[model samples]
Target chain A: MNQRNESVEMDNQLAEFSDRILNDEETARAEGLTGELADLEKTVLRLNAAASQEALNEAQSKRMLLRLKERMRREQEEKAPFWKRFFNPQFGFLVVAAALTLFLVVNAPAVVNPDLSGTATSKSGVYVAAGVLTLFMAAYWLMRKK
Target chain B: MQNNSPHQQEISDEVLIRRYLNGEVEVFDLLYYRHLPKVHKRVRYVIPPNDVEDVTQEVFIAAVKALPSFRGDAKFSTWLRTLTNHKVAEYYRKRSRKQEPQIAALTETLAHPDNLSFHSVEERIYLQRALMSLPENYREILLLRFAEGLQFNEIAEAGNRNLEATKSLFRRAVTALRHCLEE
Candidate 1:
């Protein structure tokens, strides 16, 4: 807080400004600037080359994109399951179509070669599946109507 | 792309926004890099310095989310500047609701505690309270100027007000701040 220290601080500020002025003059001279304007021209390239700024460079951008994708995926996951895409009666015929696909998938050849004795006495697997599907369809229709 | 072309000399913010929406993400980066410094600076005025960077990030996040809905009734820069203002306002609202009571308690303790001596703490509290109590527009515009370095024209554009009105608003804000700070 003494006069000496105050003057030192002022000197530092002036030096910084003069350094800026000299750089500007050099640039102007290179560009063929003439007259007093050239002399006055001070190009200070305060271009910071040290400690590179954390710009949203490609890597950082990709990271951000990944984060966004992850957040969107999580939100979708928190929503209804994929099957609801079919069961969501708001989908109406689309739901019906998905249901039919699921039905086919569940009943399609499992190659289990059903136990021949278990098959006849227990009733045909296709018949059993048809019966179950009928019940599901009826219940789904009723639920949807409500 | 010509450096000397008159049409290309000034790329309207609207065009940049449209390019961004059309999948030119680099345009978004350009827009972000262009405005982030001012946004971060504004954030510091309302929030503490420590949280300003976080607020800056939040502003950009909000901008990206809201970009799809921007039909561009106004300039894109204006829209972003508004978003920054809104985010800053929301920061204050959220902090006051979540931490004001804790801060008040802390202040009382620090002021009255027997063993610990805290100097200049009361001034800090006074500054915070004075800022928070200002009408939202006044507090916001003043901060946007001093802290954000936005020109008066830009402030008017962002606030969606006329230049004269913006100036009057700033005048009113300074008057209120002076009164509050003095008290």
Candidate 2:
């Protein structure tokens, strides 16, 4: 046989041996197997037995699925739109507190000095907005660390 | 909890994937259970026992994340197997960075008599180490055949290679593994 034909023949033999071992172990062992094919068969049988012993049972699988679900949930939360995540209950309280503080800071200046408020309030508004954004970001970072 | 409805079991993976893409989020449970045993088995075959569950979870998580882009050009199982391969590779890459001795750890675990039930633990350790030493293509073919339980023709299809070439590759791979084990 040509090399190609010989290789094909070898592949066929290996496959047959494997199938026998996998589907009918008793009969496969009964065969007077030898050489590389026999070695391969023995390896396959051992691996199969080891794999079965190591299998994750239904309860373990279910527990894994639950863990996966929790992971997927957290992933979805992280991937949610920024504003949506910002409003999540964990951050909601902080967001409400920040918004209330921002409202007071922006309006307190105007109430304090209505005449000078235009330029003064606008200037303070920039500072207050920056400060609130920084505070919000710091809070977010802290929450993530937790 | 998995919904064990009889009709749910009847839906094909492709159909379930489509349903999942179309807002049927719960359909993923069917996909998960349908393929978990084989995926888990394949992971357990190659991964260290302590790390197998984590790697299996990584595979499904990746599949779930990548589902939207799944073009259905290949079977779902094949796609998942490819994904599993990537996760296993990633596990090794991360381990290489940590510089932990994988074989030593495996051997240590095997040393415990209660943990092993199949043939000699030394034989299994050698087989696993030899498997790890194989070239990627050879190792992949072996895993595809014995680990994932793909038929020879199916392996050819998954790899997009001609049957003759795949068969030849399989023969070569088995030879290499046998030689590795012998040494």
- Across residues B60-123, which tens digit of lDDT does each residue of candidate 2 receive? 9999999999999988988998899899889888877765535644655667657664354455
Model 2, chain B: what is the TM-score? Answer: 0.82
Error of model 2, residue A142, in angstroms: 27
Residue A6 error for model 1, in Å? 38
Which window of ten consecutive residues has the lowest lDDT sum in model 2 chain B? Answer: B116-125
Shift in Å, residue B87, candidate 2: 0.9
TM-score of predicted model 1?
0.46
Among these predictions, the greatest lDDT belongs to 2
- When only the first chain is scored, the TM-scores of the models are 0.25, 0.45
Q: Give one digit per residue, the lDDT tens place, for model 1 in B30-135.
A: 5665665556555544454335456777787788889899998866766877898788778768877877732653465566666223433333345546666799
How high is the lDDT of residue B17 in model 1? 80
Alpha-carbon shift of residue B78 in model 2 (angstroms): 2.0
